[model samples]
Target chain A: MRGAVRALIALGSATAVWLGLLHLLFMADLDDFFGGDSGLRPGAASLAARHVKMWSEPTLKELELKKMRQSNAEWDFMGRTFLVLALANMSLRDPGSADKYVDVIDRIIDETIKIEAEHGVYYFLMPYARERPFMAKSGRSIFVDGEIALMLAARRIVRESDEYATLLEQRLDSMVHQMKDSPVMCSESYPDECWMFCNAVGMAALRMSDVLDGTDHSEFISDWLASIKRNLVDSDTGMLISSFSVDGQAFDGPEGSSIWMVAHCLDLVDPEFARDQYCRARQELGRSVLGFGYAREWPRSWQSPADVDSGPIIPVLEMSAGSSGMAVLGAASFEDREFLLGLMTSLKFAGFPVRRDGELKFCASNQVGDAVLLYAMVQGPVWASVKRRWNEAHVSSVGWVDKSVPVAAAGEL
Target chain B: MRSDFFKLPRIDELLSPRGFLKRAAVLTVVFAVFHVAGLREMTSFLCGMAPMTGGAAKLSALMGLGYVVSYLGFIVIVPILVIASALLLVSSRIWPVKPRV
Candidate 1:
C-alpha cells in the first residue's frame, strides 16, 4: 500500500510541478525578454549582431542567400528589404551608430539594384510570375518598384542621398503612373493579381517620400485607400481581402499573413482605417490560450490551403508561422501590449533561440523571419519621425495635426 | 562516477532516485556535447535552410533535427525527472515501506 501510495505521490508531484512551471512561464510578463526602450532590446541587438556579421562577410551571406534562393527567390529579396527597414529604424533609435547602419544599408541597396539590373525582375519574383506577361504598359512590377522605392525612402529618412533621392523620384513617378492607369487603382504584384500587402507598402513609400521631398501624395493616397475600401474588403469580416484582380474582383479573402502587414502599412497611409482593420483582424484571427498567443492564416468563415506566404499551419491550434511572425508587427504597431506579450511567449517557447558568442538567432526562423522580428522590435522611431515630418509639412496647407505615435506599453510585455 | 556510468543497472536500481539523477546527468552531458559540437547552428534547417554549404542537405538536416530533439528532451523532460525523483525520495522517508513478505 505504501509503495503504491509513494508512486502516486511521485506522479502527482511531477504533474503539479510541471503544470506550475509552464503556467508561470507562459503567464509571466515577457517584457524583459522583448527588452525595454525601443531599439535597445537585448533580443533585437543580438539579432542585429548576427545580421551585421552576415552582411559584412560575403561568404556567410552567399551561403545564407543561396539556401533561401533555392527554396524561394522571393525570400532572398524580402530578407534584404526587411533588414534594411530594421537597420533604418535602428539608425534612428541610436544616432551614434547611424553611420555604420547607413553604410550597410547602402551596400544592400546598391547590391540589390545591381542584381535587379543584371537579372530581370523575374529573378526576384517566383517562377509563376514569368508564366504571364505583366498587364502594365511599362512592364514593371509594383512588387519590385514598390519595395525598391520603400528601401530608398527608408534610407533617405535616416540621411539624405542625392543619388537615392533622384532614384526614389523616378521610381515613385513610375509607380504612381502605373496605379493611376490600373482600373483598380492598384498595380499588380503578379500578373492580373493585385496584393493589398504590396499596394499598402507602395502607399507607405509614397507617404514617406512626401515627407522627405516636400511633395504631396495625400490626394493620391486617399483615392487609393477609397478604391481598396470599396473593392478589396471582405464583406463578411469587414477586413481587407488579400488580393484582387485588376478589375477589382476578390481572389483571396482576408488572410492573416497579408492583413497583419497590410494593416501595419495602412497606418502610414490612413490611421483610422488601419485601426479598424487591426481590430477586426484581432477579433477574427488572433488567439490566446494558456497565455500563449498565435494567429491563424484564415478566419473561421474563410479558409485556404497553405501557401509559401502562410508557411506551415499547426493543426488543432491553427497557428501560422508566417502570420504569427507578422502579427508581431501588428501588435507593435497598434500598441497591443497584451497580444504582443502572448506572441513573444510563443516565440520564446518554440523559436528555439540559440545565443552564441554574444549573437542570437532563432533556429526555427530563417533570415527573413529574424529580420521581421528585428523590425518589430525597433519600428516606432522611423514611423514617428515620418508622421512628425508629414504633419509638420502639411499642418498649414493640408490642415493636419500631429497625432501621438503608437507606443507599446512598457510593463505590459 | 565516471567508472560506474557505463555499468548496466538492474530494474530496481533504474527506478531508484539515484537512477533518475543519473539519467538526468547523462542527458545534460549529451546535450552539452551537441551544443559544443555546434549543432545549434545546424538547427536552422528547421526553417528550411539547407544546413550547410557543401554538405548533403539531407544529412545536415537530419543532424539538425537530432540536435533539436535532444535539446527538447534536455530542457523539458530532464527537470521533471529530477524533481519527481526528489519527491519520491521524500515520500519514502516520510512513510517508510515495510519489507516484502
Candidate 2:
C-alpha cells in the first residue's frame, strides 16, 4: 500500500510538471503557429496552394478539371471559393502582391456566379435538395445565396466591380424578402430544415448589405434577435441550436462544430450577442491539456453522433475535425492567441503531414474540410474592415442622416 | 533420470548480450511488418470506428469493447514490449550481465 501510494504521488508529480512545462512553452510565443509570419502552416493553406499552383498552369488545370468533371461539380466550385477567400485574407497581410491575388479572386467569383446561374443552385447543393423544395417561396437557398454574396462582397472590397455590386444587391433583396415572410424571420435552406450555418450566412449577407448599400437593417436585425432568443437559443446553455424546423422547432441542439463559426458570423449582425455566445462556447466546449487545445463536438450533456459535419470524433479526447476547424475562427476572432497556437500545434503534430511545396492534405479530412480551414485563416480582414466601417457609420451621421433627412424634410415642407 | 530432458543450453551462449540483441531485432522487425501492413486501422476501435456491422446494439457494443482491447494491445502493448526488449539487450551489453557474481 505504501509503495502504491508513493508511485501514485510520483506519477501525479510528473504529470503536473509535464503539463506546466507545456503551458510555459506555449505561452512563451514559441512560434507563429497560425502561419501569420511563417506563411502556410500545414492545415488548409498547403492544400489550397497546391490546387492554385496546379491550376495556374494550363495542363494541370485541364487535368484537374477533367478529373472533377464527373464528380461533385460543387467541389470544383467550392475549391475556387476557398482559394479566393484564402488569397483575399493573405492579400491583406501581404499587400505588396495584393493585386495579383485579387485578380485570381475576381476570376473565381465570376466563374462561381456564372456556374450557379447556368446550372442553378440545385447543381451545387446536395441530392436531398431536390427531394423536397426549399421552404422559401422563391426557392433560393440562404446557403448558396449568402456564400456567393459574401464572395462577391469580398472581391468588391479588394477591387470594386460593377457587376458584383449588382449581383450582391439582388441576392440581398431576395434574402430580405424571405426573412420578412417567415413568422420567426428565419428562412430554411432545405425542406423545413433551417441550419444555424445557413442563418450565419444570412447574417453575412446582411453585413454585406450594410457594406455595399450603406443600409442599416438594425430594426430588422433586432426583431430577428428577439425571435431567435424566443425560439432558437437553447434555454440552459444560451447557445444557438444547430438546426430548426420551419416553424422554429429545435431539430438539433447547439453543436460545437457549427456554433463556433456561427458565433463569428453573428459578430457581423450583433456584436454583443456574438461575444456572449463565444464566451459560452469557450467555457462549455473548448478544452486544453498539456498545452494542446481541442474541442468536443457536443457539450458533456448534449449527445450527438459523428456525421459529415462533425467529421470523425476522437474517442477519449472527443476532439472533432469540424469543431477544430471552426475553433480557429473563434479563437482568432476573440484574439485567443494561446488557444489558437495550441490548436494549431496539435493540428500540425496529428493531422496528416504537411509538405513544403504547399501540398497540404490532412489524412483525416476531405476537400470541404480543408476549405473551411482556409476560410478561418483568411477570415479576419474582410469582417474587420466591414465591422469597422459599420462602427464609423453608426457613430457619425453620414449615410443614415442623409436618408433620414429627406423623410424629415418632406414632413416639414 | 531427468537429466537429459532437463538439460539447458550453455549459459555463455543463452545469456550473451549479442544473442539478446538479435532476438530484440527480430521482434522489432515483426512489429514493423504489422504496423506497415495497415493494422493501425484496427486502432480505429479506440477512435470509435464501428467494430461490428449489422448487429443489434448489445452485441455490437460487446464486439466494440473486444476490438478496442485488441487494438490497444497492438498499438500500446506491442510497442512497449519491443522497447523493453531493446532496453534489456542494451543494458545487458553495458553491464556485462555481471557474470552472476
Candidate 3:
C-alpha cells in the first residue's frame, strides 16, 4: 500500500513536469508563426489564397457568407471590407505578385459596392440599426461610411483609379460633414449609438485621404481628438470608452475589440496618445497563463454582457475569442512581440487551423476572423505612409495641402 | 497463474507502476483512434461561429462537441497521464519504495 501511494505521488509530479515540457516545446516554435518579417511567410500566403479563392467561387462565397450573415450581417459586410484592405496592403507589400492581389481587391470592392447599392445600406447593417432612426438625414451608419471609405482609400493607395478617387473624396466629405455636425464629433454606428472603433476607422480614412490628395483635415481631426479626451474616456480605466451616444454620452466602458484597433488607428492620428491607450489597454485587458496569452472582453472593474463584439467569454479565465483575436492587431501594431507570440500560439493550439494544398482556414473562426488575421499580417505600408506624412510637417494654420511632390513613391504622403 | 491462461491480472498487478503506465498508453491509443475517426471537424462549435442555417447545423454541433472533448483528451490529458505513469514506473524500478517511513 505504501509503495503504491508513493508511486501515485511520483506519477502526479511527473504529470506536472510533462505538461510544462509540452508547453515549452510548443512555445519554442512561435517566432516562426507570428514574427513580423520572415523571408517566406506561408501562413499569410495560405490564408490570402483561401480568401482570394472564396471570392472567385461565388457559390462558395455565398454559402460561407450566408452562415455569417445569419448571425450578423455586419460581419458579412466587414468580412469583405477587411479582406479588401488586406489585399490592397498585400498588393503593395508583395509587389512581385501585385497583379493577382489587385485583381481580387478590385473584385471585392466592386462586389461590395454592388451589394450596398442593390440591397441598400441596411443590407450590411445589423438588425438593431433600424430600431431607432439615425440622426443623420440620409440614414447613414458611420460604420458603413468608415469601412467603405477606408476600403476605397486603401484601393487608391496601391494603384490610382480615377473613378474610386472621386468616390473616396465624396465619402470622406459626408463623414466629415456628419462628424462636424455632431456635438462630440462622433457619428452614429447604430442609430443613437456611436462606436469609437467606427470613429477611429473614419478618422483613419480622413487621414489617408489627406495623404492621397493634397488636402488636410488635421485641425478637424485634432478637435475630434480633443473632444474624445474631454468627454469620451472612461473615468476608471482612462481608456476611451468603446461606444457613446451621438450627442456624447458613454454607452459602455473600454472594450478589447474596440480599443485595440482604435489604438492602432490612433497611431496615425496621434502617436503619443495612441501609445498611452495601447499601454493602458494591454494592462487592463491582456492576460497570459500557462504560456498562452488571451484577453478579456471587459476589465474586471467594468461589467458588460457578452454581445457580438465581446463574443462568448470562457467563464473562469474570462478568455474571449473576440477580444483575444482583435488583440492580435494591438500587439502587432505596437510590435509587442512577446504578447503577439503568446496570442499566436493560443490561436494555433485553439483556432483549429485547417491547411490543405497550401490553403489555410481556421475551422474555429468565420470569414471576419480570417480576414482580421490577414489584416494584421499585412498592415504596415499604408500606415507607414500616413505616419511619414504626419512626422514631416506640422499642420499649417492655413491647412497646407502640398501638391508639388510626386506621390507614387509613398514618401510624399 | 502459469497454468490458467484465462485469468485476469489481480488489482495489485494492475496497480503496479508498470501496469499503470501500460493502462495509460492503451487509453491514449483509444483516444487517438477517436481523433482520427474525423471528430476534429465537429470541434468548430467551440468557436461559437458554427453554421446555424441548415437542419444539419444542430446535429453537426452536437457531433462537434463530442469531437472537441475527445481532441482535448488526446492532446492534453492523455499525454500527461502517459508521461506520469511512465515516470512512476521508472521511479518504482529505480527506487522500490523503502520499507520504513
How displaced is residue A325 in candidate 2, in Å? 1.5
Model 3: which residue pairs collide?
Answer: B42-B64
* TM-score head-to-head 1 vs 2, winner: 1
Model 3, residue A337: C-alpha shift (Å): 0.5
A139, model 3: CA deviation in Å?
1.4
Compared with the true structure, all predictions reach lDDT values of: 0.83, 0.65, 0.80
The candidate with the higher TM-score, 2 or 3, is 3
Per-residue lDDT for A1-413 in model 1, tens only?
A: 55655655675788677755763554534454354445467667888999989999999899889877876788899898889999998998888889999999999999999999999899899999989888887888888889999999999999999999999999989999999998879998889888888888899999999999989988898889888888888989999999888888888899988898888888887888899999999999999876688999899888788778887787888888889999998998888999998888878777777788979888878899899888888887777878878866776677655444333321111
Between candidates 2 and 3, the one scoring higher on DockQ is 3
Model 2 ranges with Cα > 4 A deviation: A1-48, A54-80, A398-413, B1-101
Instruction: Supply the TM-score for candidate 1.
Output: 0.87
Worst lDDT run of 10 residues, candidate 2 chain B, spans B43-52
Candidate 2 global lDDT: 0.65
lDDT of 2 at A308: 51
What tens-digit string does per-residue lDDT give for candidate 2 at B60-99? 4454444434434443344444444455455445644333
- What TM-score is obtained for chain B in each of the predicted models? 0.84, 0.45, 0.61
Compose the digit string of candidate 2's lDDT tens values, residues A1-413: 33233333433544455445544433423233354532444444556576567546768655544333333354465556556767776667667768777877876777778878898888766677789877777998877777787777777666678877888888878887887888778887777877887777777767766866788787887788888878888887889998888788988888987898788878887777888899988887898877778888888768878865675787888888778877877887777887787776656544433366547654333344456666666567767667666655664553332121244542332
